[model samples]
Target chain A: MLNIGQHISQEYNDELEDLRNQVLSMGGLVEQQFSDASNALLNGTINIAQRVTELDYQVNAMEVAIDEGCAQIIAKRQPTAIDLRNIFTVIKVVTDLERMGDESEKIAKFASELSADTNSMGFYKNLKHMTFIAKKMLTDALDCYARLDAKKALEVSNMDAEIDAEFEILNRLLSTYLLEDTKNIESILKVTWCARSIERVGDHAKNICEYIVYVVYGKDIRHVIDGKLQDDK
Target chain B: MNNNKVELDQQLSETVGKPLINGTPKITCRDVNVFYNQDSQAIFDVNVDLAKNQILAMIGPSGCGKSTLLRCLNRMNDTIDGCSITGKISLDGEDIYSNDIDPVLLRAKVGMVFQKPNPFPKSIYDNVAYGPRLHGIATNNSELDDVVEESLIKAGLWKETKDRLNKPGTGLSGGQQQRLCIARTIAVRPDVILMDEPTSALDPIATATIEELMHELKSSYTIAVVTHSMQQAARISDRCSYFHLGRLVEVNDTNIVFTNPEHELTENYITGRFG
Candidate 1:
């Protein structure tokens, strides 16, 4: 990976290892929250939806703890170069994970609202497919982080395009559903919100992947897509 | 310009990063190598430039030859038996090791401050006046006094030591003694000043004072400092060179060296991976 965990100071090594593990644990929690929220939306499961919403506080708490840990390490160690990049990346990843948790909670709240609509079964089918791709992207991004694989992270970053295209198709489909009947406009809007939440989750996952590339390769590929840098225009 | 052709003897001459600057360098080391004995070599093929009016910090682990290279700048290693240097080290396009260039005269042009503040056992005023008097820089007693006062003021020691001109330089605090040494070094009006761990023996406040003084000194003199502390190098230097096992591994801007060094060895050392 980046040749971490071999610091001459054993305590420094342990602290960095702990920080990395904490980020992975936070990533796992975020992934679980997103998965549970997606399942609740697709299967009309209110219990899972309620649990996802409740677990968001834990995510928020983990973010605060990780951020404080980063500050403490920075003050005490004054790290530079790769170690500095690693800590900075962790700080950014924690923020993205917390936002993912928030998005998952939003998805869960919308899941409960759309669960009673038996006429909207086809919309859930489309969301299920989109959720499948988004969830895989999240999982692979976290795997890249755990492995410190910048190439894999770049691959995972590119998968966000799939999510975006799916989002566009779903938006078009929901608009068609809105035109089909004015009576179910409210339920269709809820479904659109859920799709948007899932799309946002994909965006946050892509951000995590970008951060992984930064930490491992020391290259900020945030504005680049498919090996091409985006012009500022 | 005399031709002492720099032959490429080894691959270590390919130092990574921006060792060669676009600006005119006041000092340039082309394929420099230092040897302690027949079997023992201290420095490798180091080619780098020290730009004018800038501080270049050379950093590495113990025995990595940063000090050896710094000593070579003023021919300080000539006192040691069997120590030899090869390749061309030039000061303003003049080869420093040439036979016509006397080492004593060369040192007057390039002064040095050591890790410990070794002020003369003389008075504070005399400590700053020693080089000027030795070089016959001041024509009269009043000129000598003015040189002393001006050197002390430039060294940032005038406010505290103005009243204690007759007192021994050793009687000052650790920081003031180093500043007195700096005043002495600058009294000769050297073109370049070399510092070998000049603040290692001082407290943080003293180190900070010396660092600030170095920052000010760079406006008039080309400065090169060999500091074991990476943070000191990062804080004080405009450019940084990383030495590894006598090889000049990398040389770049201070910000790039501290944050995003191009060489893997530089990154390892900066991140505290091995050394």
Candidate 2:
């Protein structure tokens, strides 16, 4: 005979797994869009930019589906404690991914504009560096989710600082280029916008890492002290 | 003057029958069942222990056997011709179903207030004194007056009706009349009190007043109530039993039932999935 308590727990666990899978799928699409937009800027390819734009639609659709799935589970199961945290976190994570998709489209537009300029190599290299860090943070955050590893989530959160630093460097370097040579000002401005988009991607990745902490420990560490993360006891 | 005095003396004797049964459970039910007839089973094999000095709330959906089970607790099901029960139910652990236990006395211990406030069309003092006089909880003119005053005070209706005890109980608002019924029940000093959807008929403010009264009454007497309101159950009950399809789904501490329900059916119901 199946005990009712165990049956309910199993149902809740299954719903959590479904939600986790949806989040991973959404994360995968956002990461791919980030990579494609960066490569388009680096290689001066309009075709890559168009491909990234097309992939944004898929990410948007996945966001809606994941949101509906989370709502259904909450209405049907009424999960509590850790399960409730996981459901709420999935809703927030998917919203962040959807915004990341919008940012990726913005990066793709910047790449298309940069493709038309003569001196694009210097701008491309800076964008590539920013994309590399943002992608790494996103990948690590998703890995933390897959393994349910709070430590890896913390590492991902810490790496966001490096991505922010890269964004600052890109900002200064692009402004210097624009001031020194006004001839290709439009191209430089486009590259700066692309760098800003990548910085936002890093921010979204940091948000996901925060959500992972909430899922594992059931704590809302968002505006609180940083050292509290280590004080899980 | 001679005829009126003779009539008053006769009425007084009918009011006080015998000495009150002291310190005993008003009603006790064990392994009770209620069926629509011989075939349609409503309440399953059930055993309940209702002691004096506590409030128990039975909560579930429309056909979850809560009302049927409440009716059985007070032997109100006896009025239903075909509804029968099995196993032993005792008042103070004495088998109530045995020939020795009178149905009239069983009802005196287990008085009920229903979902809707159904006060009799009589004066407030008359309403409070009706049950005690019938059961002889108090004897003589002065003693019945004291019982009525004390019962209304305990029901929290004395302050509102003390000067107007002679006014009709039905004239009071829905909340007050329900309290009047509670006063009537308390006047008999029953070992247990059965409430069946007592507040469903009242508004939110009235419901709050009744819930507050229930909290106060729990320390002195055992109370068994049936309610369809899940929030009311969560708010007032120390313990709760969830029923579904004539079977008891789960019984646990009130907080556990509301926040961390163990059964999927209970969880689904609480979250508004399927009732």
Steric clashes per prediction: 0, 5
lDDT (tens digit, per residue) of candidate 1 on B173-224:
9999999999999999999999999999999999999999999999999999
Q: Tens digit of lDDT per residue, candidate 2, span A3-93?
A: 1123335666566677788789888998888888877777766688888878889999998898898889878765553455667888999
CAPRI category for model 2: incorrect
Q: Candidate 1, which segments miss by more than 4 Å at Cα? A: A176-183, A225-233, B1-13
Task: For residues A77-167, write the lDDT of model 1, one tens digit per residue.
Answer: 8898778888999999999999999999999998888788887778877789889988999899899989887778877888889889989
Cα-based lDDT at residue B201, candidate 1:
99
For this target, which candidate reaches the highest DockQ against the unseen true structure?
1
TM-score of each: 0.93, 0.56
Residue lDDT tens for model 2, B184-262: 9988887778899999899999899999999998887778888887778878887677777786666666676665454
